[model samples]
Target: MNVVKRQIDLKRMFTCTTFADRVRFLIELAVTAPSTHNSQPWRFVITQESCRLWFEPKKQLKEADPSSRDLFISLGCVLENFVVAAQYYGMYKEVRLHMKENFVAEVFLYDRAAAHQEEYRSLCESILKRYNARGLFERTNIHEATLKRIEDIAQKYTEQGVRLQVVQNSTDIKNVAELTAKGIRIARSKPLFRKEFAQWFRTNLSKKQDGIPGYAVGLPLLPSFIAPFLMRYCSLAKVLVRKNTESILTAPAVCVIESDTDSPETWLQVGRLAERVMLECYAHDLATSIYVAAIEMDNMSQELAQTLELRGRPQFLFTCGVPLTNHRKFTPRLSVDLVLK
Candidate 1:
């Protein structure tokens, strides 16, 4: 089946008049949020007036994400997208975080009359347009005004203890690129890591609902078919390191999302902040690519913290710029019915 067919038609979402139907529409947008390897590690239980978001442990990447950091962050992205969609439709009442339970959050909705803000509308619209740009980025630096707007967005999250740090200096960018290369080498050197990653690496013709499809990484048909097996058995550390390093170096800047603590709550907050920042960038006609290797490896997070001289622990890393190509490709998402509990 064509993976693009998995995306819901937004026109149908607009036709949803009932509270439950609107909530369902918002959930559809929520699932489009990016996750590690497109794992979509989340579930939802919906009621007439509310929806609860849960962390689906069965979808977790055990070997690649031993700390469950990426899992919680992925949940945060879903929460942000849901909230954005709610605001766009004016169905959002409030949300409560349940850090102590497997269910991460509960969002309450109402049919109260409201006007949609331009910002929320733009963010919601970008939900479908946004994709993790995986190829090389153009050499142009992000305009100062665009950078300032993104910084302002980050400032609003300070009360939640999350900060977005942008690194544009060539020296600093190279430093991060080197650390990320080292981290990739360390990760792919382990047989288990490769095996786990291979499971989620899908070929272009795959029918699976969740996972990173080969085209997203510029893989052709034959290579995509062979990539999983190659990753599972062979050490591609050197090749991967070179490719990733080059991609990072070519970008004009790197962004690091940091939090005051390293707990699940902080991770969720970082994810929300990261998704918002990414959407804001997309609204300004820019693309983003996420890189977690540096933050996922041992001691590397601390080294990254010191290198960037950040006041808090770094939880997420990504780079944004004008991509080399305008053609966008998306990873497949499971249907809302399939994810409902």
Candidate 2:
């Protein structure tokens, strides 16, 4: 019944006939797209004929994501939602990237309406509930059937060609753990990485959401320890190196998503595929944490790909497991005003 209500509301927003109504609705949904550190580095240029999204390069994570790798990943996340939301609202939508000095996408939506499908509606519904779960997962092994479902999601729209290697074996898990530890260690050695992490660390004990919130790490006293020591040492790099290594080296399983061409479009597809996988897992009470820290370091990425026997350049390192039955806590999100332009 809730799904039905949401669909009806979405349909009304789409079929309002007023240009302002449609643009407003798209803007509302687009901003909810996931971003690194909730930096929200996107701007929308809306029109009756088309809606374009621009990456606000200034809002980007300059130190950690110097090349805007994760920025594009976040953009891909919102772009997928735009496409899905448009379809759910019975609009025929097409997206094309317009690369100028900065990358922006011109999304063309046909004024005419169509019928929304059950699958499209489902994707739209999942958007609100989707978030990263970084807690220590349950010991239960994922069923083969569930793993196959994830594969199906990965295989869909795969013509754009992203490779998702799901690692379940003990040996494979250990291999990725080693690579993750290595990547985390290397990243810690860089002063820039520590600085970036420090900037995103929130010390506010009162707020429940955003800024790698304490709940995501399941550590209540983290901010106290992190705030003082993160920037104090000349070798802040060494301190981060140990902490990061510890987190990745013990994770249950790691999944690597890669692509033949590491372009913007392909990365966006990876986001869509990942959201699908995450939502599908949510339905079955599973959880995942994305450890980009491990994959961003070149050496760690190469080792992870080799361990997974992947065919393309790796783009994301996703560590997933079933959450302990009582460990689930939905992360807070910024309200509509927080996301919408």
Candidate 3:
């Protein structure tokens, strides 16, 4: 009798509560969306009757994201999950794009029979479980079947114009490696970058409630008072160059997301697509991280774009690391109530 009761509880836990309840559940999953400094810079408004989703730009990261590109992309990540989660709960969402003042999307829902229900639930579940993996992954090679699964997920949005270029060849992968190393060197060398890094670096990782704690960053701080000041003066590039460059470029695969124009809307689209790929990769037991700092350089950006055969500018670079089998627990996040505005 106890076993039967436990099974019933498990089934209920996975069942849909209501349209409003599903939206609430999906927003909680959306908190898993990645940010530049674990900024968690996104908010959502939902009208359950109409099932409309709106993006609110109340929380913005001023220093790191000046143009709000990262924030919008992070919102896209949440929107992506909302779409998938909606389907899992027997609803389909149609996104309406508005582009006069700033790029914002209004999503409306409809009830439709979905052919691939289980797959949608699998992707939605992954959103709840995924995290930005900072640990060194195992040297295991990702299988061809897993690559194909990613491609299958990529084939979904025909409109809004998203192009996914996977780096599969040895030569191309090596070039990305070199470009990423160069990017890391550039990011580390900047005084402002180091200053920003110092601000987010909390000495007491355990006591810290929000922000990127010291432990999650995986870098030891200099003294508490002196680090920020020194970060203001030092060349971060010079510091990273001293480290082993080759070791940093060993991710299993690298993907570049491109857009025809560098508009705010396009960045949002790229963000949505990136969330899709990242969540899908997580479901397949693949670890992932984004590398925007690399494309900050002209030479590195051009080199990576050419490797991917991408015609347009390479807007974002995401390094998909296949875990080496051994896994680490995810970084902690703020409670859902705190994250939602």
* Count of clashing pairs, candidate 3: 5
**Where does model 3 exceed 4 Å of error?**
1-19, 50-63, 99-103, 110-116, 204-210, 219-248, 297-300, 339-341
Better of 1 and 2 by TM-score: 1
**224-322, model 1: which lDDT tens digit per residue?**
999989988988888888888888988888989988888888889899999998888887778888999999988799999999899988999999888
- CA RMSD per model (angstroms): 2.7, 4.5, 5.5
Q: List the residue pairs that clash in candidate 3.
A: 138-324, 188-236, 188-237, 189-236, 189-237
Model 3, span 1-341: residue lDDT tens: 00000011212324544655555555565566776676565555666533333444644655455567677777677777767766665566577766444336666765333344685766766766566655455566678898887877676642677777787666776777677777777666656667776666555334544456544434454454454455556765554443323333566677778777777778778888889999888777777767676575535667777766788778677767664334333445566556444
TM-score of 1: 0.95
Give me the overall lDDT of model 2: 0.65
Model 1 weakest lDDT span, ten residues long: 1-10
Residue pairs in steric clash, candidate 1? none
Give the TM-scores of the predictions, in the order they appear: 0.95, 0.80, 0.79
- Superposed by TM-score, candidate 2 places the C-alpha of residue 291 at a distance from the truth, in angstroms, of 0.6
